[model samples]
Target: MDYRRLEKIKRILQRRQPDLTLITDNVNNFRNLSAIIRSCEAVGTMEVHLVNNQQEKLYLINKVTAGAERWLTQTRHSSIVTGINHLKKRGFTIYATHLGDPEGICCAVRTLDYRKMDYTKPTAFVVGSEKKGISEEALENADYHISIPMMGMTQSLNVSVATAIILFEAQRQREEKGYYQQLRTSQEIYEKTIFEWAYP
Candidate 1:
């Protein structure tokens, strides 16, 4: 590999957020997944978790991702519960998107605006399928609910778009905290990711 390219990859990997990640629940649409992956890469998030139970197998759409899939680390879980538990064990505070009126609903989670919470913490944002929304298991497993405010008649944004919005907000918060200035990842991970990104 070229020295200049390797140095660039090293610089990027140094800022990769080990504390931040994403968990997508049954988001079967390839375009949405691809867009989400692209946004994740743009924001310096290196890891993404997925829970796909439906017929659709997770695959990268190169055109949609613009080749971002090769750079990200994707972890697939058997179910939402498994994914949630795994993150919890890693000391990450998981926030799942819940965009509905909780009135007349049992076990209604307290939803907060995305900006209200501190995104600089070790966190994982969870998004669900477009049609079904988030699963009950995900809601119960998540530490908090995050909602994106909308003014128009439409109550929700597409899953990929929503993920991008939330993640960018996180990036902004981390930037303010100077999270991007130095290496956040451990030595082993930083070296490994740099090697993979450069060689793969």
Candidate 2:
């Protein structure tokens, strides 16, 4: 809740033009989805596009996202391929979260595990549940793929926790590059989100 830092984030977002996104491939867990929403807010992402086959669980999503959902604009679609198409239409370089081959998540990720990333352009991150990770459609559509560097004996982080690490790392990187120092949305939307998040 650093106002100055938020202001700096605004400037950085404007200059770097980082459109960090979280895409779910048939993610059925509301808690995990909700946690991802919270992480997105912490990382200065204004929007989230969700792809699901059903909408009956909207109330569940709202509950899990809590009030954080108000600050983050979430859009939904009927399918993963449809969602990917939408993001691509908007110029995002879609990235699917898959197990990498000991290579950096992206074309130029760091070895530091939590290295700073550059989000100066449109970037979309895709995450799936452990049971089904990234779907075939999502993997096929992604421009790049990434996986967590698990030094421990365990194989993975919970979906939500993994999202937190990945997004915060991107956020941290964007901070260093000063990507959040610019305005990415209209003043009306910005003020509205701030007021809701600040007061709610």
Candidate 3:
């Protein structure tokens, strides 16, 4: 194995945020799902929580991910509620991406700008289905609702693009906070990831 390649993977592992992760609720497209996984890898996301109540089947397209799927850790759940509750117990603050009035998502309560929210802590973002958006139960379970500001006639972004945008914002916030500068993951896991990346 090349020492340079090993060093590169080691650097990435050091920056991996064990506290930061993503959740998908009923996203049906394999391409979109794989793209989300690619974005998660780019941002050094530790894990992905998938809620596929529609069916137990979940697929990740290799064409879309271009081999990125093998690098990401994913867990399957029967329902969004179960995933959200588990993350909550693990000290993660869940945020759901939904479109509504910025002043208030559902009512006049006030929705947050994705950039303004603190990502320095344990944060998990739930991106919903392309057609139906997030489920009501998922929205209700979220600690906050976040949205990207839009000005054009079309009010929505593709699920994969939206996931990338929010995750990059999180990457930015975590970078500014020096969250990525220190080692945050367990040594055993880090070693495992490096071996997988380096050997494979």
Candidate 4:
């Protein structure tokens, strides 16, 4: 590990608070889940909600997260519908990202939001499976629906790759606005997570 780069990242993490939450709605592959966990951590997300019932599948995600899964929090849910409602009740503006249209998104988040920062607010984002895309429950419950524009012959990007691209753009925009200027969490959480992330 590059100590300097790690320090730089730690500093950015100290100040950078991205108002993003991830929901895995029936995504079937362990590799994709692990990749998504990697992307989520890289982009500064610490909590992700998983909606899966199978114990075998959840365990498979450990292989993909590369133990970064240990650095973040994961919640299990029986239904995506219930999760969306819960997030909404907490004042999160739930966004469902897909490949269908270019007009609705506001920034370049999991979907784009055109508005400026109220960074202290809570937000939640949902990523769909590779083959089926966003589910109907997410679509019905989300406050906004978004898509990434593609010029290639391919219609959609891989789920993990798409997650990294979208999340980094959100991080990039947040960083410029001095979003990471202050520590957001308790020092205990900060120390514990950083140490676990570095040493584990």
Candidate 5:
């Protein structure tokens, strides 16, 4: 690789947050999944976890992902419970997206403002399927239920849009904490990732 391109890859790898990630629960739509992956990449997220119980395989739309999937490491799980358990074992704090107290009815899990949460720590945002929202199991497993406040008549945002919003908020917080100014990934992984990203 040329010096400029190699340097560019190193710069990006330097800012990558290995601890910040996303976990999707049965988000079957390939377009939505692709967009989520793209957003994760934009925010310097190095990996993403997926729960795809309904389908045998998960596919991505190249047009939506815009080649961002190639730069990310994706882990697929058979169920949301399995995915949550895996992340929890790794010391990741789970933040499941949920709109609690809809129509004045109290939800079992209370919701917090997404902006208020600390994203600089090892964090994972759990976004649910487009149709059903987050499953009960995911909500129960999450360390906290978070939501983006809606102002108008609309009740919810698109899965991809919501994912982007939350991920960017994390980017904002991480930026303020100077997390992007230095290399957070280990030296071995940093060298490996930059080489792969440059060569691939």
Candidate 6:
């Protein structure tokens, strides 16, 4: 690779947040999925978990993703429960996006101001399908239910747009914490990723 391309790859790798991630709960729309992956990549997210029981194959629109999916590690789960369990085992604090009353179902999980939460921790955001919001299982398994305050008549934003908003907020918080300035990934993984990105 050229020196410029190598340097750019290294710079992006240094900013990658290995601890921050996202989970999609049956987001079937290819355009939305691709856009969500693009936003995740823009925010330096290293991995994304997908839970789609309907289709075995996950498709992405190349135009929407803009090749961003190539750099991210995408894992498919059989169910939302399985996905949540996997993340929980890996020490990821999941934040599910929901618009309903925080205390409607149960008081255990309360909706918090998205900006107030600490994104510096090992965090993962869960977004559901376009038609339906997050599943009950996801909300139950999530560490917190978060929502963006809406001012206008529209109840919620588009799935991809909301994902971008939340991810950018996380990017901002992580940047303030100096998380992007230093390499958070392990040396072995970093070297392997750099090799793959530079060569592929």
Best by lDDT: 5
**lDDT of all predictions:** 0.88, 0.70, 0.88, 0.72, 0.91, 0.90
Give the residue spans of candidate 1 off by over 4 A: 101-110
Show where candidate 4 strays beyond 4 Å: 1-18, 53-57, 60-63, 103-121, 186-200
Residue 179's lDDT within candidate 5 is: 96
List CA RMSD, all candidates.
Answer: 2.4, 5.7, 1.9, 5.0, 1.8, 2.4
- Cα shift from native, residue 137, model 1 (Å): 0.9
- Highest TM-score model number: 5
Clashes of 1: 0
Model 1, range 61-114, lDDT digits (tens) per residue? 999999887777899999999999999999999999979543424335557788
TM-score of each: 0.93, 0.75, 0.92, 0.77, 0.95, 0.94
lDDT of 6 at 36: 98
Model 1 RMSD in Å is: 2.4
Kindly give the number of clashing pairs for every candidate: 0, 17, 1, 9, 0, 0
Against the correct fold, how does model 6 do in TM-score? 0.94
Model 5: ten consecutive residues of lowest lDDT: 101-110
131, model 2: CA deviation in Å?
1.3
- Candidate 1 clashes between residue pairs 3 or more apart in a chain or in different chains: none
Per-residue lDDT tens digits for candidate 4, residues 97-168, read: 777646544434354432332333576778898888878888888887766677788988898887776676
Residue pairs that clash (backbone atoms under 3 angstroms), model 3? 104-110
Worst 10 residues of 2 by lDDT: 108-117
9-91 per-residue lDDT for model 2 (tens digits): 45533442337787877677777888788778767777888876645564446666666676567888888889989999988
Task: Please list the residue runs of candidate 3 whose C-alpha ends up more than 4 Å from where it truly belongs after superposition.
Answer: 105-110
lDDT of 5 by residue, 82-144 (tens): 999999999999999987642335465467888889998999999998899999999889998
Clashes of 3: 1
